[model samples]
Target: MAATKTRTIEQLVAEYAEPIADAVGLDVDDDDRTLSGFTRLLSDAADMLSPADCTREWLEDAAEALTALGYVDTDTARQAILARVDGLLYEAKSDLESC
Candidate 1:
């Protein structure tokens, strides 16, 4: 059997960034400021998520990155994070039910 390759978060992020953005209604032309900002935000989030250690520190960095990007306010970012977490938890629960 061939060995599996370990892909970095950055690589995966870069590959799916456009489609992910599109799903979230962020897909826009290259010249669009909103698209650029979202791309930068995605890159920052990927960097924060790429490490094995310092999970809390990485979350803090990610939160800062969200606000520093200047498109999303702190409250909005917090709400968004919570929303995603809730969605994931719901999905997990559904998966467990099926299992």
Candidate 2:
């Protein structure tokens, strides 16, 4: 059996950040301050999700971070974040299943 590889916060952030920025038509330079903030948000989110334990606090923190980052402050954006996290969870689950 293969060993499961857990993604680090940095890795996941790097993987998703550009696509998200592009999707929103934001010119997020790699060295930009906003990018750094986004990285922090992503890191925090990843930490909250590290153990695959979803707590209300984690969810709330994530929503706040997204709002602060201007991702969106509506129900739709919250749902989108949940869906994106779900995709990440699916990836993690696949890794575990393969192991």
Candidate 3:
């Protein structure tokens, strides 16, 4: 039996970021800024989505990472955390939104 190969999250995301960006009419170039920001956002998102972890503290940790990365202000992260508790949340729906 052969072992399966898995891609790093960064590699998988890099592969699709540009075309996905273009498909939705975002003028995202495959330059350093575009690539770096996309990688950061995806990393934070992946950290947030852990199995067996849905506590307020868990969410706060995730929110803090996003704020630290300058992806969201503290207030917006708070709002998102609250919304998540209320069962209203944004999943991986829009690539433009990630940017």
Best by TM-score: 2
Task: List model 2 lDDT by residue over 1-99, tens digit each.
Answer: 975344433454565555444433345455533435654544444454435544323433443444443556676555555455546534533443343
Worst lDDT 10-window in candidate 2? 54-63
Q: Which candidate wins on lDDT? A: 2
Give me the displacement of residue 17 in model 1, in angstroms.
Answer: 31
User: What does candidate 1's lDDT look like per residue over 32-56, in tens digits?
Assistant: 2343454464444335333553432
Q: How should the candidates be ordered by lDDT, best one leading?
A: 2, 1, 3
Consecutive 10-residue window with the lowest summed lDDT within model 3? 85-94
Model 2 pairs in collision: none
Give the C-alpha lDDT of model 3. Answer: 0.40
- Runs off by more than 4 Å, candidate 2: 1-4, 30-36, 39-99
Which of candidates 1 and 2 is the stronger one according to lDDT? 2
TM-score of every prediction relative to native? 0.27, 0.33, 0.28
Q: Pairing residues by index, what is the TM-score of model 1?
A: 0.27
- As a whole number from 0 to 100, the lDDT of residue 53 in candidate 3 is 37
RMSD in Å for all candidates:
14.0, 13.8, 13.3
